[model samples]
Target: MQNRPDLPHSAINPQLVWTGFMAMCVGMFMAILDVQVVATSLPTIQSALDIDPDQMSWIQTAYLIAEVVAIPLTGFLTRFLTMRWLFVTSLTLFVIASAGCATSSSFGGLVSWRVLQGFSGGTLIPSVFSAVFILFPKERQAVATTVAGVLAVLAPTVGPIVGGWLTETYSWHWLFLINVLPGIAAALVALRSLPREDINTSELRNLDGLSLVLMAVSLASLELALKEAPTSGWISVYIVTLLCLSTASGCAFVWRSLHRTRPLVDLDNFRDRNFLTGSILSFVLGIGLFGSVYLMPVFLAFVRGHNALEIGMTMLVTGTAQLVTAPIAVALEKRVDARLLSAAGFTVFAIGIAMSGFQDPRSDYDAMFWPQVVRGAAIMFCLLPPTRLALGRLSPDKVPDASGLFNLMRNLGGAIGIALIDTIIYTRSEPIGRTLLARLQAGDTDAATFIGVPLQAIADHKGALDQKTMAMLDPLLQTAATVQALNEAWIVMAVLTGCAILCLPFARPVAPAE
Candidate 1:
């Protein structure tokens, strides 16, 4: 990251830096968008392939497992490869894999390509964060990171809109195919415009085998356990066994990493207090970000019968809020305390989520506006400072390792957040149904509305209610219970996000405005 006065000007010139940075942003947007895009089209894909529901989940799972497993390895790869090659290779591999996925004729073929795409996609993400600190000088980085922040926030929210249009207007195959042109363009730009750095051939020579195996196994097992925990029941033998394997392998990896002469990743980066606080914040942010995204889309599509495009449109408010906030965040970071900015951000975000926790069955996009705006506007301040806290202050040698771990923690939190939210809804559904039933049986007039039944109508047909009307009773009850469950999930997330505010005090202060 240190400037090399002897290097060619094209590598560090203002124009090249901006182009290279924009290319990385395109690559990042494509990679993140692909994850959520495919999610929206899963049913169409399953139907097109004639695969069973059980087997269909694996389409997503395979990609996720591969992605998570490759994320931590980016640190090791950085030792031998410059940022340019890393960007070029990842985009190339991702493009080829996307083509394969688009043309896949069988279930197995698609899954194989997805795994490759996922690994390549994983490498694209951390590279952007690495680029922020490496390619640009500290004087110029705030604007660069603001741009990255916009991509990071916008891509996930806009994914459904893009995916729905492509899938509905065309075919599910178009989802993967969409990445090809952008991927090629990004790779070419990065290869041509990005500055190169001298590689550490000696560090490359000491790549540890045992640690890689353990990390791969641990992360893969952990991802599987999280994915399956809700369906299998957290206490079921299948989930328990996988968790145990993950823990053991993870412990073994840490042990070997600490003892190795040159570990794949430098484990000592966690010793930095700023990095530690940043990582914890990253983990919590993941829960808030992924958890809300998962919950909102499901609520819209399932409870309200909204299409993917409609859901995407509703999510736009959040993105717009984030877009407006990015510049303010950039301008403020130079003058404000990082910890205070982060605390204010999380506090506002938590309040937004908590507001949504009170939504009823009648709530729609109109009802969702303010909360979405609050959460959206808060993302910049929340993410920017923590990122600065985590990698901004690290020595050039430690930035890679710290970046890897920082991003990895966020992904892990997301994996765990989705599973926990699913589990809570399942466990609460039946109990909430029972409680509603008790109130109805006891003749509580208000309880009748839980099933959309009028107290007067029930009284009018007390003994002569038709069989057709009775059939709807179960469906109505289930709907009511689900709405209640979603409310509870939002509340829990709000509390979790609110608690993140407490971590702000632990963060090392940002350097004062010059």
Candidate 2:
């Protein structure tokens, strides 16, 4: 075995390591939070920048595509540059990019800055995940993972509220400006505290340039294809071409990786049964986690006519529940079989998703509270176990690459899950709206009630309603249809999450790594 240059336990300083670890967590949190934050305030950004509605989605897509490409490259970068240098450099660039984003006056300028932000921010997740194993000993790893996992899931949960408050109180520029101070402080702390090792420059000389290109092409094209698939029909030539490019490039990258002694991404990580099953579970959890987050805001803003802050305030229940349950989850993780814990977590989470699926047009804060609580309470279990199952058995030197692949699964799952949710909403809403409209035309009072029109307004008029009255009701009908469509998307994700449990049996039991 090669003698990796990890810091020895005897030389460790408890205070500095903890400080550095916390700094890395902050950086990771900021990165993950930016996605949801921007999502919540995108309308404000679009209006302020005078961006066309058709081009508005590019702001999010460019960031995401850049992120997916950067994730798998973390392992190689870590090896070449060392964790400390990689993190500090990435965070510094991220902060600069955030500032750039805030000052941009045009759509192209904002998108360019966002791409830089995404690539830099994308490295933070796997870096923190890798730090867990590198920085902590066996007994402390579970606690470390629990802390990291809590923050990882918590950021997205709280993002909408944060974004909403900032947009309402200040302006859209504050959204990116918020990261500047904290990011700088984290970079300084990490530079001083994180362990340093001699850089391996030889890795750069041996780097497979072709494999790198193949991966970038595959991931970027796939992300673009997913972004367009809902708006453009799946059978459309542009989408089909992108999908083919992604598939062919992905296959070539995998083959080349397996053949190399030092591949950019370690494809061999998937050979471990526990890791493989855990990655699958991570992907499914992403669907439920990211999909649920996307579903709630849409339901609130469009269906219930809530503003950004109100949407955030209403969904705050989930983050509150997660915080309350963190200690209990941490305790259970130390005593429980991870597979069983994961199974229980996914089951409870599925129930939460399904509960929201049954909601009507009238569902509001009170109606959503318990479901959010259920899902939030289950989040730690969902994250902690799969993380341990996947990376626990790997060697010290291998953890970085393995961590990249592990984290990438969840992000990929999220991208695909959001795309699917949008497809269901876009294609099904018009048809569903027409059906409800037909029922109302036939004098079905139930349809009127579901669409939230007054009994007195439509009851006597019945089939003889005037054009003005019908026009007034059109928006309401459309909203109700969207709500139902959102519910269907929720149910689909719930079923997908529930089926993830059956795969749990395949994961080998994980004991804490030595």
Candidate 3:
């Protein structure tokens, strides 16, 4: 057998290598897809389970909290179990948890299964990213990363539509059930195709119990705080306590990690210039990616009165454009400097997001089409370049930990970005609504026109609408205000994404693989 510099020495058969990797990608896709699928169909799930509206959020929140707690631990898990078994073990559990979720008859049971699903699913993401660098040589890394990156980003794009159709055409139970067969096949293929390795059970002895506790407490608290902060005032006592606990525990964990010879998570990876810059870009990209996906559905459903399926179909343009542009992105990534490609991606992405910010209350599919296309085309560019920038320069031994930290930033960015978006929508909507109402009362024809109430109607009413008419107009006023507030949130995402480009100057260019 001959060894080539462009392939890992262990990769004697490229076909088997790719098959194994793609199998892992399937697990990653299902894991990421579950989040979006469950999210869009929450109302349906809530109705079926008879869950209290306030507590219904726990369905998603539990998963998020558990997932956040698990993401950084992936580096240690990989080292302990080895990549082959780590992936198989996680995916197997994810499958079991999905089945549990599908069969649960109560809220508590559903949430319990979700926690397990989230924890197991969380490990799949970093494991796949780490494999890109570990399994392939630099010359082939871009293509490998593109395959993983597309699935990672694509899952979220397609999730809403898949979820909507499933829940509408079949039932909410199918959401979790859909993962079962694919998960089983992926697990089987990954087990057979991935290289076998010895698991180091001895790594268990060196694990810091207290540090693990602190890390779990820190991430869990932070996720909880973010989830509640948008609705509950950020300074509310419960939210403040959660923030304080998260900060205290997080600092202690970091301190312990830096001082240890072999820590569970390597916080020092951020000190690398390219890795740090790449991580920042990943974080901001999360804001735009998750935030944009979130904003469109809210607008379509709340303001436009579209159902889950309709909203999903409307959002499909972004996914379509992403698929269309993926090859072009891969081709460019191999030839262009990563930093330059990243700059161009972010610039176009910001323009795309900014375009959505100008929509009036009546904005629908036609209004949103180009923006989705622009953002979609830019998604691969956003994902592939920053990925290479972050992990491309790191040594193989350091890559697993670095991948965890790099991917962690993006998830954190999403958690925080959504919270920020919600806060904007919640806090600003009322004030704007009040202002709009006052204008309408003062016979402002523009205010009437904005909410789709005819100018003639307002003029005919002579600034003295009956109570019944005012009641009917109230919901319209609120919807219009929310639309305005949503536009404001879109601009915030655009600005945040645009500002990500500023960090590019700090990242050293990754030289082409020889």
User: Model-by-model lDDT, in order?
Assistant: 0.85, 0.90, 0.90
Best by TM-score: 3
**What tens-digit string does per-residue lDDT give for candidate 2 at 207-281?**
999999999999999999988999998889999999999999999999999999989999898999998988998
Question: Per-residue CA lDDT of candidate 3, range 282-388, in tens?
Answer: 99998999899889888988888898788888888988899889888888887898899999999999999999997778889999999999999999889899999
- What TM-score does each of the candidates earn? 0.95, 0.96, 0.96
Question: How many angstroms is residue 453 displaced in model 2 relative to the true structure, after the best TM-score fit?
Answer: 3.6
Q: Write the per-residue lDDT of candidate 1 for residues 119-155, one digit (tens) a residue.
A: 9998788888887877777767778878987898788
Residue-level lDDT for 401 in candidate 2:
90
lDDT of 2: 0.90
Error of 3 at 358 (Å): 1.9
